[model samples]
Target: MPTILHRRWLVGGAALLILLALTAGYIFLTTAATAPARARIQAAASMRPFGEVDQEVVNARTLVEDTPESARAWSVLGLAYLQLARETADPTNYGRADEAFQRALDLDAASVDALIGAGTLALARHEFAEALELGTRAMELNPTIPRVYGVIADAQVELGRYEEAVASVQTMVDLRPDLASYSRVAYLREIHGDNQGAIDALELAVSAGGPAAENTEYVRVQLGHLYFATGDLARAEQIYGESLARLPEYIPALDGLARVRAARGEYSEAIELYEQASARIPLPGTIIALGETYEAAGDQGRATDEYQLVEAIQLLFEANGVRSDVELAAFSAAHGDDADRALALARDAHVRLPTIFAADVLAWSLYRTGAIAEAAGVADEALRLGTQNSVMLYHGGVIAAADGDTDTARTRLEAALDLNPRFSPLLADRAAAALAALDN
Candidate 1:
């Protein structure tokens, strides 16, 4: 087998004159009144450049300073910190966010905004059960709040509670058919193999988002991803280019474009983009992608360094109480010396919550450890939603082939190659070889 590298706004207005300025101020005040402080925070946090994120953090801090007893101000500060953390990939910001959320709760224990913020932070930390509990409580506090449903839906999705997630997201879209709601719908549809439906939802998401906001660019990238999954590389490339035009530093867009380049066998161009993407967001996945590119180019030393970087980052995350279970398990299954340890870690991760991603790792690990029957079961879970991921299908196909499921293996491997012929330099070559063997 060959290598595997598949990865995955606010407006401000100025007043014309003093009266115009006052009128704008009055408008903001009235809007804030109806929108709630958290909504306003979310809007500001989602839109514009990092300048706006910084400004919001400052503004929230000032508000809390002026009114220490105001739970809303504290919650707003917490959310701004969280947003900053997301943009910068700085885990320290999460600590600051934690304090801000707790402070908000201290001021007002039943504050739904604070609860939701905390829940979201938990989700980021991969504490799915905790996130769900916090989300559930926040929902009980206010059922009509759209964002609360989103938090709960996200938690459910991570926990493999797809039916519940679908129901929750339906309510979310019904209440507010905006970017957040439409994006969630897009992903659910994609997972369910409804490619057309996914594309339709993402288009709505793009339309619902304002140009000034980064969310608009984000949705554009999602639309590109749907196109990519359908093997429409030209459309995917076009959409990704559009997204980068608006949000030049968006890591996901950079990574998506990098993958597109790699799939076309543009190794040098792919390497350049992957480097830029990894520098901005050195997550395990991005690093892994970079490693695959290096390996494809026969730069074994650099590839080894990238793998070490992933391990170091995983350790750092674990130390910070952030569970990197899926990444850790996947990495171990692929690279760990001890097959038993790899299988155990994967199994443990799956037991916590069988996310489709976790299930894929578990299947790979089980196969590695020669637990063929269990691997088959785990593979079923991985493909349950019909996710069109080349690496996942490749792994599943190889596993099934080892277990004497030639028919299933051929179907999956063929689908992977059809989806993206150059999905992984190693895996693609491997898939072709496997299919040839099965035919013989």
Candidate 2:
């Protein structure tokens, strides 16, 4: 039996010891739980530039799957899957990424990383509404998350909500100030008739070192396009050359260089560059550019050949379940000397797409074959789509002028110039001539 004072001392000492043990144990558990999350964050940050890290990501995914209790682990797994999808462009990878993100959401419904990754995948698939919803949710969950705004910007761009895209990208730049956000914003500026603004934004993008080589190359190519659009062909040529120096196989740079050369009346040089680009990508845009270059060079035979190749590719694409009616109509109308074939292709495309661009092509094909009335009808239908596209407006104006509707022709031609003041010199010259003819 201890004395009263001695027993009080003994009890106080035991309680102090218990408190110290509990504090030490809590610190140890917290650190143990957080170590893996910190490591995963470090790994993800390191793997951003190396797009070909699919195998490493798969291993990370396995680790996360094994750790069912860790929300951060699921985020790591989702990010890995997203990276794999970006590298492979396999939609299945996106599906897997979505599943991983969904698991993360289940674990922690407010996970910002999961929302951003899921939104990004939706954007890549052109599911704009889903992307917007997910991106908005991500921002709501964590307003500080820069990638959430990036997802929103991409979805806005795909939906042709350029103004909203610009605002979202601006917010992303404000937060993280990364090259991707700047590049996208610059492109939107260019589309909105702010050529200098685009150049400034792209300069910032080039200065920002976070963009990978491929992304930097793309930015340079876009810079060249902006310069070309602003009639600074020399600067455009220099930028394209720089891009090519950085990535010799960059097809967009080659195409940009070809356009600049063609503008400078170096048709043969332009034709060579266009040919190289076409050989590399074989895309409809590249093919069309090559044909146009050849046509500028007065080499109708080569131009016809390029257009025929485009038609062949379009047919192959269609056979492979890829609808390319708009491209097919464009190539056929411009290069198919057989009016009947051009009209047939254009009609089929109009029936399929029914958009302003498709309708414009159908109208142009009809006009080429001297069917003014039908062309006018189709062009009018195109105008109802409410897209103030310069090219479409120009086509409609031409059709109306051909049909002796001087008032409508003047209105549309003026609208085209208002929409795109630098709308191709050829089209502008035609518009001017039509207006002069009306006056006379």
Candidate 3:
């Protein structure tokens, strides 16, 4: 009886040992299966919004090669490439982003996120037609998706369909109510002569909360521009200062602030800002601002240097197959009386662009050269565009007065004053004098 009891105990011990071994094997297999997924998740979490995350995402792309079916991996790749494109502005980065987005689309053809990214790339390239098509298709594929409408709105705006752009942006606001959409709507309103509407839209944009840090800074800069355009120089200065506080190197804000200072007759302050902006982006606009400010400060030599720099920039753009006729004409007209070189440039530029503003410049340049009859014809063409721009109206008034058409000159000059009495004190004073002479 003792032997039989000992054998039963041994059998039970063996069974318990087998059960323990099986449980250990199951745990090992489960952990091994989950290890790769955990690694992928960790890698994704390490990706930042706009910095080193771009490189990390590129590295993650290699790891996901074996997991081509991973939709989330493709999505991460797309986002990383998009951010890289935004930071670098290298069109090649946009091309890479497009491939990444295409990969995401391949993984999930109905991916609204991928569609939006692709659409944004098209928009950035100024391929407005393609952007509109892609954005519309994306929206049709998924109406509830965010940001697609914003892309469409931007495309429409570039195409000069302002009303349609506004409607599309409004829909985006209803769908996502984000800052990007709101800001775009504000720009459209501002262009449509609704300053108050622009301010209201921008205020909503400020409150909309979804703006990324860079986007928030940009929106503030845009607000400064809106204020400047509406003649609120003080408010413009304040907004630009706020943006510079957030992003000290923001060129657009710096330029706007400089313009405000120049308008307020603070030439020294304006020059400093213009120099900073010029160092960053030596475009024609910045150079012209700097030249004008220097001239205002009675620094003739410095102003000449700035104008020469502008001429060099124009030559560079022309070499690159990008025309700056309008800018050249305006520059020429501004300094034609004192610079023979400027008058020659104005005539050539006016012949190229042939826009109303260009015509006005050509007319002014001709008038400086004692070519009143030629100036009169070009000025008449300029008025035919019916822009109602105060500067253009003032130019028409000047041309009419030069041609001895007192009635027409008074009409145009009065129109210019009614549009903006403070358009330019010099121009306004001239208009007032011309009208007084007509009355006499």
lDDT of each: 0.74, 0.65, 0.62
Of the pair 1 and 2, which is ahead by lDDT?
A: 1
Q: Write the per-residue lDDT of candidate 1 for residues 384-425, one digit (tens) a residue.
A: 888888888898898889889999999999998888777675
- Tell me, by lDDT, which candidate is best: 1
On residues 146-180, what C-alpha lDDT tens digit does candidate 3 reach at each position? 57777787767555455576567656655665576
TM-score of 1: 0.86
**245-302 per-residue lDDT for model 2 (tens digits):** 9877566788888887776678788788887765534455776777877776678798
Give the better candidate number (1 or 3) by lDDT: 1
lDDT of 2: 0.65
TM-score rank, highest first? 1, 3, 2
lDDT of model 3, residue 177:
52
Candidate 3: regions farther than 4 A off: 1-92, 95-99, 102-110, 281-284, 295-440
| Model 2 TM-score (2 dp) | 0.61
**What global local distance difference test value does model 1 have?**
0.74
Best by the TM-score measure: 1
Q: What's model 1's lDDT at 105?
A: 95
